[model samples]
Target: MATTALGEYLSARRAQVTPELIGLPTHGVRRVPGLRREEVAMAAGVSVDYYIRLEQGRERNPSAQVLDALSQVLRLDDDAHLHLFRLAGLLPVPVRPAAPEQVDPQLLRLLEMWPDNPAIVLGRAFDILAGNAPAYALFDGFQQGPNLMAKIFLDPDARSFYPDWDEVARYTVAGFRLQQGRSPDDPRIRQVIEELSQASPDFVALWDKHEARGTRMTSKRFHHPEVGELTLQINAFDVRSAPGQELVVYHAEPDTPSATALARLRATATVESPQADQDPGQPASSRSSWSGSPR
Candidate 1:
């Protein structure tokens, strides 16, 4: 029988949960890495045959109660739980083709106003749609490109730029998985996934984990070539004006060493000025360029 997406997800998640994690005894040598099929079914309050059917692609539709119980037994977090529902067709998935991402003029202006904060707009596929001067300075080590996944995974500089490279890579992969779940048919997302899977073994490993999460309010540490070490708090917001666009802002706490470093970096950074003939309403990508050495 052909494997269903829901079945694949359930199987992967189940394998990650060991019997000991859920208070099940290991009476003998176990062949499976996680709980046995019967164990999961009994723990989730479902029959062995029913749970087997669900994992075998014989049962496509599971009620909310069944999914919820299975989710609990699988020890899935909120993001992973939502991903399970999506895989089971319980949540709505976007079917429309993703439109070309364009940052709103108002949003661009807002980014420019915050010279102290590093802000950038990212497309659904993690493309760097637009960024302010400080933002460019912060990411000066990265190659000038649209897609961030390529820069993070393909570019060697990323490893050093982000001191906690392993953690960042895992977080990024999980967030990308969440985005892919929402827009499964998106060609760009598929392209990135395929390209990275072939190029980066690290990316492939994280992708197979099937973790789903989005960028949240968190602090990140960076090793800037010019500014040395700096820690910044990240805040991600959905751009209501443009669907599938996210505005990410990074700020350092006032009076802290990181804040001082950020201020110093922003002051010395030499950002390219917009051309006089260029239309102001055009997306920031066209107006500003990321070139030359880090200033």
Candidate 2:
């Protein structure tokens, strides 16, 4: 209906480019920074007039082919390429969405049965879709206002949560960036990204690098306030039937202190009940402590 918003994207990207990047000759008198529309058109195998029209918002609809050409010539990263499509009003290529990812009833039953193992099911955006009692007790703090990303990045004692805090932060940001690339328009995701960017310089630095990686499997350390540090092998798996949902299971080495700590954590729940169902019997802070237990 209306002309696209390509002008701003084009302008911002243009200013960031240097003459050397596009193989252009520069004289001492050349004042404007970055590649001109004509130079970009030449590099992209398009005419100057067409490029000008696109930049001026006169060309509202560009084919995927054309967008691809511009993307390559400008050396736009994945995020920048997607942003260009959004600004150009070209229907972005469809991507997977982390919609209602329901856990299998059988899995729920299994979790209920195992009051001893700490476990949780997470969605693509780090939403805690479901978790078990042992998991609830071990990670009690992260559960109440549970946002996995925020917990890792915003919490004051996050370093204490993970002994390898730097590595953990990098992985967390990279995972968040991957989801952001998939659904840039989600306000909640955007808000989390912005909030984290403002809150953590390390997070901001990692984001600026434009890294994107999914957390499939890793080892993590948890410094439990009660039981000291526990190292566990972390396993992450996707529910093929329910796209975008992942089951992250934590296992302590057999007969280790971590395992003993987990036993103590699990002992909190002699009988597994739905968190809401168990709340009546437990104090609010005690319930919170159960949910905030470390993985």
Candidate 3:
């Protein structure tokens, strides 16, 4: 019904926040998704009409105290909190476009050095800007392009790859939303959203929900086709030298089955392993810079 960005976010977030999450009871005949408008209004210490207006795009520029209260009620993480401020035009600093999408030569070399670890560098749009052999093996074959958002939503195998598919999808969309804060008119963001919306209903629903998720270190479980179930902690880092680029590394606990699987994957990897360092077109294998040859 022609929603403003703020309104769409508030509405979707409200839907995802369960009554029990914020200590509300399961009342009978509940029809609406997530916490009710009245419940949110009461919890945020605002009038019901005001809350509705905020969700409907009739109200914007909420005071810091009000925004903080709403964030608490919705259980938003730190990244989501900043995104909310940015959406309301509350952030003090002027927003700038993400730095030019470039992966330093040294950084690519560093990724190759981590033979045992599955590491990848992600561009702003979640494209696999570069990755090591293990990281490439982890993703393996996916019909959807290298962009993670596309693979998660469009690929047929993602459901089995990620045990908790719904949760992962939500977080991915939220991360994209957080990126949106940095560049409002980024064509890449718009392109991904439009294509995914038409291709996957799940993406459409999650995107409408407006969960602003900042990239953070977290644990994730994957059912690897080759290695069975593996629990790995995702270490996400912002490249200080190149803003908007993330160096993500995967770690499995020592002495665990997952660790053994990782070792096996490393052992199998050879000097002739597939190159995951760049997009499909330009393979790094034939290039002159071949010092770290996937060993």
Name the runs in model 3 displaced over 4 angstroms. Answer: 16-31, 34-39, 47-49, 92-100, 215-217, 270-295
Q: What is the C-alpha lDDT profile of model 1 across 72-100, one tens digit per residue?
A: 99998899889889988999997745556
lDDT digits (tens) for residues 38-121 of candidate 2: 888888888898888887778778787888888887788775676566656675533554344456665556556655567777
Clashes of each: 0, 13, 1
> On residues 195-248, what C-alpha lDDT tens digit does candidate 3 reach at each position?
998999999877777777786539888887777888888888898886667888
Q: Local distance difference test, per candidate?
A: 0.80, 0.67, 0.76
Best by lDDT: 1
**Local error of candidate 1 at 235, Å?**
1.0
User: How many Å off is the CA of 35 in candidate 2?
Assistant: 16
Where is model 3 poorest over a 10-residue stretch in terms of lDDT? 286-295
Query: Who is ahead in TM-score, 2 or 3?
Result: 3
Q: List the residue pairs that clash in candidate 1.
A: none
The model with the greater lDDT, 1 or 2, is 1
Per-model TM-score versus the true fold: 0.91, 0.61, 0.80
Shift in Å, residue 257, candidate 2 = 3.7
Give the best candidate by TM-score.
1
User: By summed lDDT, which 10 consecutive residues of candidate 2 come out lowest?
Assistant: 281-290
| TM-score attained by model 1 | 0.91
